[model samples]
Target: MAQSMSSPPPALAARGSQGIILKETSGSRLESTISGSECRVMEFSSDGCQLAWCDGKSVTVMDVPSGAVKYTISKPKTRCIQFSPLGSYLALWEPYAVTKDVPAGTPNLHVYNSSGELVTEYIQKKQQGWCPQWTEDEQVCARNVTNEVHCFSGGAPGLTCDNKLQIAGLTTYALSRGKLPYKIVVYVPGSKGAPCFVRMFAYPNLNASAIMASRSFYKSDTVSFSWNKKGSAVLVTTTTEVDKTGASYYGEQGLHYVSARGESNMVQLSKKGPIYDVDWNPNSEEFCVVYGFMPAKATIFNCKCDPVYDFGTGHRNMAKYNPHGNILCLAGFGNLRGNIDLWDRESLKPIKKLEASDSTQFEWCPDGVHFVTATTAPRLRVGNGYKVWHFCGTLVQCEDTPPKQELWEVKWRPFPAGTFPTPSTSSTAPPTTIEQPVQQEKKAAYRPPALRGKPYTYKLHEEEPPQRVGAAEEKEKDKLSKSAQKNKKKRESKLKSKEQEQVVITRGSKRGAEKDDALALAAQILRGNKDKVVDPVGSGKSDSEKKLKNLRKKLTQIEQLKQQQAEGKQLETNQIEKIKTEQSILEEIEKLTLS
Candidate 1:
């Protein structure tokens, strides 16, 4: 029932009609038992330090570790007891007989501090199925009855019923958690064929005038709502019938996004039919919805209700978002092999799928990296326990509930803060220095020539003489000639052996002696050795040489044409000069004759 991070094993306080027993889970042993009147209900505080129990007429608060009674209060008829989330106060409900002396509207619930001091009492008409609810921070307590919601706040004198809000048709409610300002979401059914409304009320003072109702949707009888992690927005899933059938009918469902300030937006989640569920991401940036009927599909959506991603999950039964992380776990009953898929919000994809057959419950550890999944099992069977798992689906531990005990609930304790070592802050003290061992530089090992990355250079063992350039060329030519002769002899021998030898057509032997010879002759020609053109048999003259000869002839022709053009230009210049002189002389004669 309750576990503490400070302790090695979890402490579970089990209560039955006989007595109350506090058992340690690490070892199958009872630590302590408070045996008296039949205990009706027992609950451990959020901090796991205190345990409270109520029998029909009296309430007892006991220290969990020492089994010591801390406080006890007795009433005429106590119905139930609930400890505040912060362990500061306890709320006990008692039903008083509605007689003539007692008015019709009688305050039956009482609030008391840890020291058993009476805090407050309210005149709420006790309902058959109504129970008091508290905000996550324990700053406000709310009691819902019919269409009215009563809220109380802790004050100087006692718990005061500060605000009471009345909606037309109240169905369900959810309280915001975390650091955001506390808000209460209440669902009000539509009146006279109108749409249902989701309303938000500020905590401590939920006045009727301050009700902020969200945009309404078509007539939906079943509505489920969940608050985002930071309480900035609330996600509402509504199922509305499409056809007016008396007995059985199909319906449509939609997911509505409403901000803390009552602004609303919605998207049709299932065109096929009503959506099964919707869960919000821990960061309040996105949420996921399970839609479709058979072979249901799961879709993740942003705050705007826009679809981010979707996957097919066969008949999804439940989907939950981790409170401390962005991982979403979806489980369905249709799959016998794989039933759970862990989706990562950052990646927008599933990171793991687990094959947990018939898993009905999932609880994430406070660390967020690990979770626990449990499956229902038949009595006296072995499959009833839970398995601790990392987010990757690896099993960390498996635990079985005590046989025949019928596990009511199992939860991982919230890890305590300040458990990690704090940094040292003694600045006045001398700083301690640790001397590290001096490491000697290691020389690299020698690598063989074959293993070295660079080409290995070897010293010549002996030197004969300084070679001339032509001498090296001559040696290469001699080697080529000898290799050619050897190839020719082999070809002749093959021909002689074969009586009728086919015409041998070779594209230069593999040794490539002909190619070497052509290269050598070209080298000589480029060096202006006109007499050394050694053309190999069966090969024509080198094309390179022919191209060189044609280039030279064209060059000569170009020079000759340039000389002829220059001579022609000189002749033309002389003729033009003579003509100009004659024209001037004729003009001088004409002028003299005219004068």
Candidate 2:
């Protein structure tokens, strides 16, 4: 085993013969391929020095650099595997089972060390929240037990539970990473009229008196937690079994932020629909959330929960920040059309737009400049494959499974922080070595022959147009002061009065009312009221009829204003202006009838 193994390459696992292929991250070259019964589960050590996989017969751990089998444990039924941050320990989980000989069932979760020695085990019945958590130093290990959390101190080899945090209805717990004096956050679902709560506690203390932050809310049956990279705070996504409003079939969800320093806030989303995703920036000072109904909106908010930038509404339901936190990938998949949009967080400009149809998994490379998207099996039994992409939207590598074979999963090997520096933002995308088949454009839906060229006033939904990234901030900058606004209105009023007075002076001209009406029409155009004077069809007799109809509508509005004025109501500026146009409206009606 050599120190060079500290940066392992990515691994791919597919069914049938292709057990596991370790591919170099620098290019589309195969580093090594380990074939077995079937590579069902594969994981890389946090340091990337070792690679482990289970093929139904046994679990194998290999030193990445030497290509030597460092440890082999016979765990035939293992379903998942994970390695500690420092690669000091490995954890394996098997499907929970019961037998006549052992009715209660055996401990299905096993923890082992680098020497292939069993260190600990637990009976994790449910597979949902199965993996154990470890601090960055691997000094503290935490696992969820029945209505409690068991904490193991003194890292691997001689790990032992030295403390326990007890909480009734404890369903899930998350361990924060980074330096020691680690923190733990726990979730408790509500029952018996109590509200669901998520609370944080500093490590070792593990008591009520040491609780740092807590949040309580209603309508939550389960929750998922996401801690920022620095481990300063955590975002809890609360979800219910059903949405009471019946607005979404996916259920109702809310996002809440809880920091380590006793500060908490329920993140307020602008839209009123299901929350699709929330990802914290690597800097940990800001986060991005994708929420609302179909054609969802994505917004970035600061620590105070104030929106910093809105990505606007789109057919996207997921937002992911790259390893460097400089790039963001907002994508729409599953039920919506598959469109992937890459954006530069610093510039707030879109980097690239591409599509990976039927993609179910996405992962960023340790280098932060490249990513991988895959369409795996079970989620989609057909078209199981994966593609490697540059952040600038280039398809660097594409691997489609053979017709008989099905790809299950593809993973980028985990590397220690600072192992690979973030590529410069100005760098261009690498030349595409793999070509993706160009898909045909979807045709517009069929319309009846009679309505092919006819104008229609129907729309399926109000599709919001694309907006500039800083449009809101730009508008804020363009806002006028109160005094300036008042002066502007005064100037507009004087100009309108001057034009009206000029029309009155011309009322005595040779054309009389006809010339006066033409001036009034010109005034309407200057005031942005051309729609009121112009016939949309630009036709013959119908144009005159439309003008007469508009004039009668204006007279009716004038009568309503007079009634309001008689009732001692103060007319608004625009309302008073409309009243003054009444005489012009009557003159226009007479001219239209004569014409």
- The best candidate by lDDT is 2
Stretch of 10 with least lDDT, candidate 2: 1-10
Candidate 2: TM-score? Answer: 0.76
- State the TM-score for model 1: 0.56
lDDT of 1 by residue, 1-595 (tens): 3232233334444443335655543435555455664555667777777777776557788876576889888863676666776778777777655777765757677878888898777654544434566666666667675687767664222344577777868868877765447788888777777767787877655777876656677757777777886888888877666645432266655678878766789765643655767777766787777776556667767776666666654646677776554667777742333367777655555577666654656666554555666654332144465566656655555555665544333455443432322211211222223222233455865778777897546532222221221445567667777778688789998878673433233333524656656654554454354664544443444665445434433434444445666778444565455434543443442343233
Best by TM-score: 2
Model 2, span 1-595: residue lDDT tens: 2122223335443343466777664455555556663788888887778988888789999988777899799998999998888888899999999999999999998999889999888788989989888888888888888998988887752335689999888989999976766899999988899998999999888898889999999989889999988888999999998988998887899999999989999998888899988999989989999999867889999998878888888889889998879999999877667789998889888888888899888888777877888888778888888888877777777777888777777877666777666666678765655666586698987799988987766876565654554667568557977787788889999999999999977765536546446645654554354555633222233766656756766777787898899999999999999999987886787677557
* Error of model 2, residue 88, in angstroms: 0.6
**Residue ranges of candidate 2 with Cα displaced over 4 Å:** 1-17, 25-32, 157-160, 454-458, 465-595
Can you list the residue pairs that collide in candidate 2?
Answer: none
Using all chains and alpha carbons, the TM-scores for the candidates as numbered come to 0.56, 0.76
Cα lDDT of model 2 overall? 0.80
